[model samples]
Target: MARPIWSGTLSFGLLNIPVSLMSGERRTDISFRMLDARDNTPIRYERVNADSGEEVAWKDIVKAFEYDKGSYVVLEPEDIRSAAPESHDAIEVEAFVQASQIDPRYFEKPYVLVPAKKAEKGYVLLREALSATGRIGIARVVIRTREHLCAVMPHGDALLLLMMRYPQELVDIDEYRIPEGKGADYRITAREQAFSEQLIETMSGDWDPTQYQDEFRERLQQVIRRRMKDKGVVRREDEEPELHENAATNVVDFMSLLQQSIARKRRTPAQASATGSDAPQSDGPAKKAAKKVTAKPAPKASTKAAKAAAEKAAGAASKRASRSDSSPAKPARKAVTKKRGKVA
Candidate 1:
């Protein structure tokens, strides 16, 4: 079992459920270590005094807060501890908001909530109540000496505690350069909308996750594997062909294109049927005539040579079986003779 990083109680109104928080995720990425180019060895860093250019020991270092340029204030551990927020060891729920009301942008790191000793009943009750109500609990928790806004939501049979971003952390959308709601009115027409709907209907199908795959990632891994094996790798440069010489002159004929596409699809089945069958009778009259034009004489094999090879194989197999059968009989006779000798 994995150990929890945090232990705390969830408090809302009169209810309290003791729970522990376990880290839920890990990142696996290729990384590089800082190394010296001359020696090809790892490089180490040291805290040093910038002005004196002397390395400072850990015990000699003190935390400082810079108030103004070239001016600083040193703070002791006790002073920082006094200014810290109260660690209540509890996740206090402030509100029960609709899950859809919350913007997805505010979500952050996730953690698994596990019931501590003697807290199983309360944990299950909270999980079931949240699942039944279809709402998430907005709460505040102090983890690692820092206060964090969090959401406690039911995921399957257990609770998922997720850290949330503060409202101040979100950037205001109004500051960005975005299109005003004017030009869109002239672009969309009733007929164009109907054609788009028809196109969507033709493409609509069931959502099967198994049908979708990361083809680029698979190809990338193949390339990497080939490189590792010291094989020559060929990289293809793919470029999109130019759509049109000029936008104004290139007008689309939607109905004509659709008709041509349907015709091409119909021709495909006919072409497939013509090439698939091996029997001469399966092809139509025109195909049969073409087949006669392309036909070649069958290659001949000597009947005597084939017969000799088949007889040799059969004889070798028969001899092997006969030897195996006689060897087993010899062992049986030896056993019988030993039994008679003992009896006599």
Candidate 2:
């Protein structure tokens, strides 16, 4: 089971419903890390003192507000804690309004509200009432440290808490120079409008999101798989120093170590040092046995040989793409025929 992000009470008038907030979205984007291209070593980011260029420990760090140019007001942990909302564990509903009254733009992220143990009665009551009346409860909820304006509404069988943007955060539509009049004002003839409508009507279908896919991501994944199969991947070894639990208390000769580190030239890990031999490390006994039986360790290839192999893979990918492009697509999904409007 997925862990709940927050456990809180949902408050409205005199009623209180104990609930847990669960994330409603999944992140599927491929993440890339910055690396030193010269040696293919992963880059490290550190918190360093700007003036001294010395790394600062996390325990020594303090929050500060920059009130003016080159001026700051340091705030302690106690100071920040004091400023936090008094009832941080409650999603207090201020008012109930018609769902239509809220603009689509105001909705940001969504979180599903799950009823706590033995709290299903109140949860069901709110969801049913919201669904019947077509109303959403405007609530103020504190998730983590920041307070957010949210809407608690009936989403199928559950109550979904959708984070909302503040009024000031939204830009007025009057700021843009949008067309004020109908198609006639833009010199569009009735025949053009009719043709456009006809085109739209012919292409329209049910909104089945599963039918659509992130084409770019899929294509990128295919390319990556092809490259991994042909060129293989470098197995990176972690080299980060493990600090003791009480890092502050652990005494060490830091100045000497810093000087030594600065003087030394960083090199690639042993596994990746030999170019073109990037076979993945076997993690399981079955994989180890398979590696031993099927493939021998690749000998370091010449620069010319590596280039030729890369070119071959590129050519194969290009042919596959060409075949895909020539294949017929569903009429509704792709433009099968172009209908031109009559020139008036």
Candidate 3:
């Protein structure tokens, strides 16, 4: 087994278990190094004293807190450890809260909690209890030298210790401007609303995260590989790609797109019979035809109320048309001629 980054005791009221913490995630991002423009040499960094410009040894370094300008309180390693919270060897559970009550932004990083020797039963018991109650434990833990707010919860086979930020650490959402009042602004119609719903239904599928991969990263790697093969290599193109004059082509009117989507879904059986395949379906051609007629002409705040109004209006119009169709038409009245008095 791989060596654990941390070995500590996980504690609740009267329960305790020896646990090892290991990172839950690994970064796969491509890393880059800075190079000199002329010599193409990799840069080296060094720590130096700002006043004397002399290189400082790592062992000689001491951390300090500046309480005032030009004044600092230097701290030694032993002094710092002594001042830290007393429960350094334990994860002390303070409270348990509903999983839904936690704000997503507060959680920072996660680690897998593995059971140590003789602690297997306790670990499984805690994991099962957390899963059954649908609650997560809020706790304070000291991972290295720094203390952190953490959440202890159940994972598939092991427990997860998720680091969290204090409430004060998060910036208030009110600091930024955002669209308000349930989108009370967009002029959405009933037809559009119905179509959008159908479109959602047609496109809905179970999420499989494995189906997607990083396209940009893959393309970047391709460029890197091509350069490695030949330094002077240039990308070749088959033909000039067409440029669209209308920017609104992609941000299509929601309702029109939705209707097209539904129609496409409904036509699948007939299309399958003709093609003899389950694939090959599209709303692109239909959307292109109706783009000019149904595109959202103005870029403005769109709201939800449009659906209610448009549907009501459409329903009323339909009722009026139905009533007119069933009723008999009235005949036009003939003009009455008045007998004029005899004039000489």
Candidate 4:
């Protein structure tokens, strides 16, 4: 069973909905460890004093604030505990803002807000209200002894609480260099605008997450499985086929390529049907050829005698074709020529 990381009441005005926060997602991936190459042993890290170049005990470490260059004021655990946020079990809603008002970059971790025991009525009410308003709830909540700026928003029939970055945590956007444009008149032709709109229409489609996959992950897992089965890693083929220098320069005509692809697809069924019909007719000639090519006792002969025997065999084949009325006899001469050419 899943456990709730936080349990609190979502409060706004006089409304209070008891909710339990639970982590919604997880990552499963291969992790690597740093190791000593010589002995293949895992390497460990140590906290050290930078100035002294010596290891420091965990107990000796304290949070510090750097007030000046090369100077720091250390604060103890007790000092931080005293300065911690006030403990609050409630999520205090401050305002309702348009969902689009928040920049996605400010969003951080997410948690599912499930209705607490006996709080189903209040939870449904808040979910319906937010859905109707189409606005997200801006709230503050303390989690893990730290106050977090968060947004409570409706997702389907439930609430999704996302931690947001504090204003101070984000760098000012204006600090980065931005491109400047000269004050000049610019115009777009009506034809160009219409063509751009048509191009967008041609590429538009509904978003379907099911059509996408992590192909790299799947391939990596296949490799891992093969390795575990005691198979040595298979190297990829090294041969690179020589490409025609003017292949791209020749430029494939798009319309012709599309027509060719359609034609190939249309021919597939016809090709299959043709093969099915020809199989029976092909069997008779194949059987006759097999019988004629069967192994026979060799006749001893001199070089001249061997040439004479070859001429006799050719004469006999021609005589058999003249006697046979079957259309198969015509192809027999072509097959013999092809076979002799291959052998030579």
Winner of 2 and 4 under lDDT: 2
Number of the predicted model whose lDDT against the real structure is largest: 3
Query: Would you estimate the TM-scores of all the predictions?
Result: 0.61, 0.64, 0.68, 0.61
Give the Å error, residue 257, model 4.
16
lDDT (10s digit) by residue, model 1, range 1-344: 88888898988899998889999787544346998979979989889999999999999999999999989999999887776668658999999988999999999999999998999999998889888999999999887657899999999988999999999999988999976674346464565556556656665679999998768767777777778787666566688774442243226655455443344444455675776743343335656675666652221234444444455545545677556645535544454455456569
lDDT values for all models: 0.75, 0.76, 0.77, 0.75
User: Runs in model 3 with CA error above 4 Å?
Assistant: 66-73, 183-194, 231-252, 261-344
Ranking by TM-score: 3, 2, 4, 1
What RMSD does each model have against the real structure? 21.7, 27.6, 20.6, 14.9
**For model 4, what is the C-alpha lDDT against the true structure?**
0.75
Write the residue-wise lDDT of candidate 4 on 1-344 in tens digits.
Answer: 79988898999999888888889677667667999989989999988888998999987877899999979999887887676667568898999999998988889999899997899998988889999999999999888767889999999988999999988898888899965553233243455445445555655579999999878888878777878786776665598775332232325443343443344444455785876654454355766765666622223334445565456557658688557545755555555565576569
What residue runs in model 4 are displaced by over 4 Å at the alpha carbon? 49-55, 168-189, 230-344
Q: Write the per-residue lDDT of candidate 3 for residues 25-76, one digit (tens) a residue.
A: 8887778899997998999889999999999999989999999998999988
Worst 10 residues of 3 by lDDT: 331-340
Q: What tens digits encode model 2's per-residue C-alpha lDDT throughout 1-344?
A: 99999998999999999999999999889778999989999999999999999999999999999999999999998888777788889999999999988889999999999999999999999999999999999999887777899999998999999999999999999999987988778666676556555555655679999999989889778877777887976444578774333232226443343333333323245635654333343224556776776664333334444555555545555666555543323321232122111112
